[model samples]
Target chain A: MKRHQNLLMALAVVVLVALPLWMVHKPAPGPDGKEAEIFAGADSQAEGLIGRIDPGYRPWVKPLMEPPSGEIETLLFALQAALGAGFIGYWYGSASTRARLQREQETTTSC
Target chain B: MHIMEGFLPAKHCIAWGIASAPFVAYGLRTVTKRVREYPEQRMLIGVAAAFTFVLSALKMPSVTGSCSHPTGTGLGAILFGPAAMAPIGAVVLLFQAILLAHGGLTTLGANIFSMAIVGPFAAAAIYRLVRAARLPFGVAVFLAATLGDLLTYVTTSVQLALAFPDPVGGFWASFTKFATVFAVTQVPLAISEGFLTVIVCNALARLNPRELQEMRVATGSEQEVQA
Candidate 1:
């Protein structure tokens, strides 16, 4: 039963990922053949809408640091996440190990 | 939804910030109380925040030939409840805005309101309701995570609609347009997130029943054995 569930989940993931990729990459009927970017991050899409709504509107704020390139931006984001995950994983592992050891020592002393 | 830098009018941004302030305060209080009661939970909260950060950073292809990321609040909401997740989510959003340039400081309040407060609360509510219904753990997790993700997008759509109502059809029409666009990407992402959370939850339950128990996830039989 467990194996069946896992297989189903794996299949679901493949389909979910593949369907989108295929849709995105498929040739479009437009003259340009380039598909329009229908899905934008909420921020950009919202900004675009705001621009359309009121052309004279100026942005009140700016990003603190913009990465030199998109790749660099992605790299920095990934780095931060990795560092955070590493710290968290280490902390959890050590705490759990210490707790187990303390429990074992208590049982031995009691015996 | 991350309202871009200068996307929302100044008033909208300030309003969202004010709206989220109380929730953030409450969440900090919850975290402090938990940490005081159990020093180990300090690390757990940090781990939860990191987990949210890492998972949300994963970009996936969407139906519209664009990339979207998961919100990743479901697992944390399941572990720590919604109130506790608010502060953790705030940290993640702040990092994304500053480091990734994904969101802006001015829009941070709106982003936090949608992704942090609303998303986690929705996830927690759904998880609790489904679990109370005595459904399978996997099903509950899947529903909570998927719906939580969808709800984030929905909230974002509403925010956008409110800010820029369509000239022709007004707020409702504008909202529909935004929601439709978001749905194309978000629906698949939500399903993927649901499966991922369930897999992660199951793995945690098997490998670290103690952690699951500490987080108060009902590991059922496995937890019983460990106890």
Candidate 2:
């Protein structure tokens, strides 16, 4: 039952992520009878809004290095996720193994 | 919530940097103290950092027809206290700033202040309040994580509004516009983050109850949710 709950929670996260995409794919018609734009980054959207709010505003600084291309940026993002996920997986394995071993030890000693 | 690279004027950037420095320093100290006191927690600390790393990289879609990633600092805040997330978030933001050019170095301070400092502190406070009300563990964690995520975006909106207030409507108008772009879009992603945090905590409760207990996440009587 406990494991089932965990699985369900995991599934919920997936569904939540997917739900927005599904909504966007077939969005309800707006007042103008137009479909909403596809999912763009909120950060960029905010930048656009800022431009509208203050057209004269200019960014004074630039990134130290650029990703060179969209594909490269995606690659870097994927790498970040991969690195983090890898460590998480390691921690889970270590923790689960330690817990299982300890449980076995306790059973033997209690017996 | 990245205000983007160099989006904030130089003055705002410097002010944010000054504002964020003390928190980051305190966070570093807190982390060092925690490590010295409990060497066993090193792995878990890494896990918290890693969790931020992964979640920030994911730009999930939102119901507002936009995408934004969850800060993912709430889990670390709840686990390691709010202060610890400052450095952890700084590192993740630094990674994005340097490599991906997603959030720029100039804006790192403001981004960190919003996502790392404010979000974590807010999450921790919410967690405390919800737990005090005797809410279930899952409910507390969900509220903390979700609200924390939303508040980070709200902070970003505030930063942007302060930087570029509307010519006609001023700060409030700019704030509403930015909030519509960032915070409204964040709702679904924030909920997703809440569920993800809860799943991670539940797994930790089952697999490493002792660590959870040491972190005060699984207290006596309350820890029984692992069942």
Candidate 3:
């Protein structure tokens, strides 16, 4: 069970790191007052040993060169939505905490 | 409110992971002691199994159509006490993951911590407080139900914020979005849950006060320990 959790965590790390890096170089400066994000082409080649075997290789996974909405604010919030999810996790741990607190209260009350 | 995939920042997930470790440990310890102290371990396990089946199987659609199931902790908390419910909820979540695939096994701790540990406490607290205020049983039940659902979302939002914190938007905005997702759908669902919980509580109250007392002893306030 623990190993499965580790594997999931590892997969999450790999995807999170590689995907964003594979897609965008940086947020571009917009003509207006905003900053724009530029897209990376799937055709761009990797230089490492793995790529040496197949120099002309393309990535199996490809995301749109463009951001989902092209809005940094929305994209940022979407990220937040994922990260903030543990609030529910904390709630899941609460019932036992309740019983513990109540037990403490009972002791104090009796005293 | 399973927190959705790719919703939160990595940091939030890690922090929640840290926060959950102790709860899991403590819940296991307490549950072990309870089973050892009591003679009806099998019966208790059966009750938990049956109760949990209802909790996950009785799903109704929420805003996202992601299929929200009842935490069902209100009655469980009132019946058992919050401590005992942690393992039950965790087990139920485990079962749901295997049987229903409603939530992820990777996120099992997070799910158990929220739905089981948190839901019952919020419900039980509200129940105790409302009853102490001399409110009607129905009102007490409704308030507990509402708070349980609200707290569940709040916990979920916090988890999201921790998993995916952004320096620009900060935690508040993140909290707002997550909370809103729940608020839109859960507000109505909770109202109905409150009505149902009230009905159930009232029915059980009438049907068998002794069972309620036993459950309360199993799950509830610290006073039971001293008694």
Model 2 lDDT tens row, B1-227? 78888789999999999999999999999999999999999999999999999999999888887888988999999999999999999999999998888888889999999999999999999999999999888889999999999999999999999998888889999999989998999988898899899888887777777778788885434436444
Comparing 1 and 3 by TM-score, which wins? 1
Measured against the true structure, the TM-scores of the candidates, in listed sequence, are: 0.86, 0.94, 0.56
Question: After aligning candidate 1 to the native by TM-score, how far in Å is the CA of B199 from where it should be?
Answer: 1.5
lDDT by residue for model 1 (A1-111), tens: 755776788788779878876676545667877665544464566567667766777877788888889889879878876876687578658766876787799899999
Over the true interface, candidate 1 deviates by an RMSD, in Å, of: 3.0
Q: Which candidate tops DockQ?
A: 2
lDDT of 1 by residue, B1-227 (tens): 67777777888999999999899999999889888887756655776677687767877777766667788888888888899888888888898888877778888888899889888999999999998999988999999999998999899899988988888899998888788767556888899889977876765565556666777789565645456
TM-score of chain B of 2: 0.96
Scored by lDDT, model 2 comes in at 0.89
Question: After best superposition, candidate 3 residue A46: deviation in angstroms?
Answer: 33
**How far is B113's C-alpha from truth in model 2 (Å)?**
0.5
DockQ of 1: 0.48
Rank ordering of all candidates by TM-score, starting from the highest: 2, 1, 3
> Candidate 3 lDDT, tens digit per residue, B1-227?
45422222344445555766676677678777766765444343444434444444443444332234455566556555566677767766664454433344555566666777787788888888887887766677678876786677677666655554444677776556556555544554555555555554543443333444555522222343345
| Model 1: residue A1 alpha-carbon error in angstroms | 5.3
The list of candidate 2 runs beyond 4 A from truth reads A25-37, B219-227
| Displacement of the residue B42 alpha carbon in candidate 1, Å | 3.5
Q: Who wins the lDDT comparison?
A: 2
lDDT of each: 0.79, 0.89, 0.52
